[model samples]
Target: MMTEPAQNTIIEQHINLDDVADLNDTNPLELLVQATGLSKQRVKDAMTKGAVWLSHGKQARPLRRKNARLRLGEELHLYYNEQVLSETVAKPELIADEGDYSVWNKPNGVWSQGSKWGDHCSISRLVEEHFDYNRQTYVVHRLDKAARGLLILAHNKEAAAALSAMFAKRTVEKHYLAWVNGQFPHDSITIDKPIDNKPAKSIVTLKEYDADKDRSLLSVQILTGRKHQIRIHLSSLGFPIIGDRLHGEPTQSQDLQLMAYKLDFQCPITGDKKAYQLKTWT
Candidate 1:
């Protein structure tokens, strides 16, 4: 039994089944329970949330089943992040249910996909549980966890492939809203600066300006989807987003004033144009 100290952080532990000959036929849950001194219910929840893992010579992968038998040389790992497991995520609203795909208004702080820590707070996992796992859920696109708005979820693999291609090819028209500090200098501007040594472009237009608050609301469209593209571009232009802590000027509000407000694209399955928009900012 190897243990990583829980310094108010993720307590990682690895258990080798071969060492304890008597525990050879024991289930993964029991091993985790005895190793971590956590209750069975807590271990079960951790497994379901993707905090547990198994490895047998191959790469480690998340394990969710309790009854899975551990092989003689197999290893069971637990990443117990109490904070991640206890935090609650707001439910996303279903905007439209296309038979092949669906649109959802992901709330702020809800992740686009799951990490090794957990999946319950991710939109894709929520969609899977929403359908009772009857339909296969796939993530077609993603939004920043700090920024929330319309996101697409595919029910099957075919839809996922088609929609993913559209986004990769930049055929999908994406629109975003951001509130920035002070009055914007231009009505419209385009930034084509390379981000992370990758070609990325973002177009910004002044939507409205609040004279009293000295803030400007801007409309942003990205030609290439790069990580933090909009925030980086806007900050370079001198008007960082109001709450973009990473790339923007500091502000009182912790909530990021960014939203993926609209998405328009030709339906891959029906060949019909479809648009989804969120009036959250309006």
Candidate 2:
């Protein structure tokens, strides 16, 4: 049976998963202490008990498993007893390019942007630091910090506007890899769903199968961008991605086997189609 923490001692905050980037690099226990004004031991105990909700991984245990080490560009949800707190941290290697756009391989656990207080480190800040002198960078789109993948950054307003338009028009093609719970149906399947007042399409291809675990590795191609579209759609299809705490069962592992492995689009500046592929796991 579960027991609740002290009512008066309980702390909670509904943090946007994207804002977690700010807390990267800092000790998770330390962050919790700072946020809740609690003792280090208290924070550590909660963490050891798996009270932390990470953006891309399973709920964490109180024990500081080495795998539980937080990284930049990741978001975290923390609860002390029953109180919740959230934070985002930035990546150290984020960069931007002169073509008006830059690409980043965002690891799971960070936020693309954040709220005030400059409390969380986010991809926007990571790019802002790279272009701090100009302060003109913009996020063309976002990747869930817990979902590792390729992210494109706009260096200037023009580039940002153009890329935003492209996404709105559904002209970009995005591909991802996910490790889902259960044997996938076939070689391929397409998910056509309306997402947030927009049309969303996804093509899933089976890549590998683990018979012992009854899980399938899939390559997901998205014809339209939507918040949690693939994760939600796949979960709706009864194959929720593993380690996805929000839409799937909680696992012992800390990493979600989902990666934005590929992206294809026409450059607004070059007027030519360009494709970027990243195989972080394959």
- In terms of TM-score, the best-performing candidate is 1
CA lDDT of 272 in candidate 2? 81
Q: Write the per-residue lDDT of candidate 2 for residues 1-282, one digit (tens) a residue.
A: 324345446565334435565544665665556566666766665554446555545443223442356654455566444322334354634423546788877767767764322213567656666666376558888888678878888877888899999987878888899998788887998889888778888899999999998889999988877788888889889988887888887653757778887878888787988887774573
32: Cα error in model 1, Å: 0.6
For all candidates in order, the CA lDDT equals 0.87, 0.69
lDDT of 1 by residue, 209-237 (tens): 99999999999999999999998999898
Tell me the TM-score of model 2: 0.64
Where model 1 places Cα greater than 4 Å from the true spot, the runs are: 1-9, 18-25
